[model samples]
Target chain A: MLDAVIIVLRETLEASLLVSFLFVYSNHFSVNKKWMFLALVSGIAFAVLVALQLSEISDLYDGTGQEVLFITVLLALSLLIQWINFIVIMPNYLKSNQQLLKILFSSIIVLAISLEGAEIIVFFQSSLANDNHFHANLLGSILGLGIGISAGAVSYYLLNQLANTGVIICLFLLVVVSAGMASQAVSYLMQADFIESGYPVWNTNTLIDERSVIGQLLYALIGYEATPSFTQVIVYFSYVLIPSASFIYFKIFSVRKN
Target chain B: MVLSKTGSSVKAKRLFLIHLTMLVIGIFSVDASAKRLTIEIEIKNHFFIPDKIEIPANTKIKLIVHNRDSSSEEFESYELNREKLIMGERKANIFIGPLAAGEYPFFGEFNQKTAQGWIIVK
Candidate 1:
């Protein structure tokens, strides 16, 4: 429930931000509100339909297909987080108010929100996999969604209040955290044998069990692995640490004027 | 901000009423026949119409399980000791006892993906 809530909140907030930004932009250009709302609703509806389609597809292939789908989603999510970091999050640190950047952010936000809707479907389907009470599960999901939307609204309001400097720093940090967790999730799917094998670097399960609460939290947040294959660890580090260090370095030294 | 204008107040009120009416309709429709519980089970591509279910205690339910997929699904709850084999575009009926309020899990034995649902006797 908590995991679902967090994912929903993050995804919804990203979508809300995009929509609000578009509203503001539309006002500047005097775009038709009716058309704008229609487009937005259609996008959301499409996302929901895709999610339902994926759930149905998962049910067709036996358990193996579902496992493969999970792996694919994790990989896609990881790549998306990285792409967002490289495109929107990083460039913001170097310049202010670039029109192209704004357009890119808006587009990415729409894409992310639509995909997030699909992810929500997957999450709910998985939750119901073990149980069959449609009413109960539906009630719980509705409650979760309500909370998520509230959180998203609050986060958007908060983001608007923060100073530009703070927003920049916080946004960058958020991207780093999201990227780290995404990378770890992908590595986990790979290790689970849902995906084809990559090289194994080391095994450190003896030192720390990944199943422990603290260990799992670390793994979710920072891509910590006690026993990771060589390629997994390298991929994790390269995706997170390298870009993170470079981002910090560039922010502090290279882009001093901005 | 433009929506806050006086002229738009009427439009806003109308919109609010429409939304309210829809909400009320949705809620009331759900409670239409208290005894005739209209439960909807989603049949997706690869999974059971419903993976799990919960019910109120001692309630007679008209279990409306719909398999919206091409593949057939079976709804079986071991605790309830009941199984309903529902084929594609079909539904099965099982008159459950006045079960006590608790969690009873069910699933599809053949297609584990499509076979799962539960009854909550609350």
Candidate 2:
């Protein structure tokens, strides 16, 4: 039961950070919250399908199917995050263009929930099985899930409270997380043997243990890895560079035009 | 040679694009031709069979993990940097390699106390 709690908590903390970030962004723009509802329903549907078909998924691509699925999803999610960065940089983003941004945010929510929700569904499927420990396992899962959602709700309000700095803060989080997810996509590619992963350039495990709770939360928010390969680091920084350059370009040129 | 501001900016942008392309290609040099060594690990009752594995350093290897348990388990290793959930009575493949010579510990997250092992890259 304790292990169940830990597992869900880890997955949820990782997922909810991004969800809250997107929620804040959508709120700032006054885009319809319908995306949140649509995302939840579709995402859970997709997750249930994935969990049910996992055996087939495990066998695909000569047993590399799981990695392939993760790579596709992570890359798609990363692309969605990158789009958010672009929208944030647009000088007129706040006052207009809510419709397309609405779709983008909705897609982000769908992908995020689909990715994390599958694990929860799989875990719960086992927990709900007939056994004496069923009650304990179910309780643990509910408790863990509650903690995760509560943390996300608290963060949403806190970021909204920042008011003036909210957009910048959200944008910065998006940039950092998107870059990290890009690196994760490449790692998945490497895991599938679709690409090679050179030995890690550095190991920071001594400084921040990856197994610790703090390490888990940092990973959720920033894509933190104690040991990162050369390809992963390069991919991460390249993502960072593109968005920063776009923000700077818009800031300078938009001001000049004004 | 002196040029207009637009010409200089255009040249710089072109240079940047070319370098970016090179960097991308350099990073993703997929080697379909290289054969990979395959290793098998069995998980029975939340324990890694052959709890210690040895492999050559700096070589990619395919790890076939078969879960023989009646319950699901997650194969996680921070040192080798991997996490995969293999449902009960199922199997999965994880690729890890070109690692520096060292002992990387791994465990089943669902049963961490009993499910433990090590990969010794030499």
Judging by TM-score against the true structure, name the best candidate: 2
Q: After superposition, how far is residue B2 of candidate 1 from its true place, in Å?
A: 83
Candidate 1 lDDT: 0.52
Candidates' lDDT values, in order?
A: 0.52, 0.84
* Sliding window of 10 residues with minimal summed lDDT for model 1 chain A: A191-200
Pairs in steric clash, model 2: none
Task: Indicate the DockQ of the complex predicted as candidate 2.
Answer: 0.38
For all predictions in the order shown, the interface RMSD in Å is 16.9, 2.1
Candidate 1 C-alpha lDDT tens digits along A26-127 = 343334455545555665776777566653544444323333454455455455545545543454542443444344444444454555566555445545
**Model 2 lDDT per residue over A140-249, tens place:** 88888889988988988999889759778888888988888888888878777788768888999899998888888888888899999899899899888999998889
Residue-pair clashes per candidate, as listed?
A: 41, 0
Let me know the DockQ for model 1.
Answer: 0.01
Best by DockQ: 2
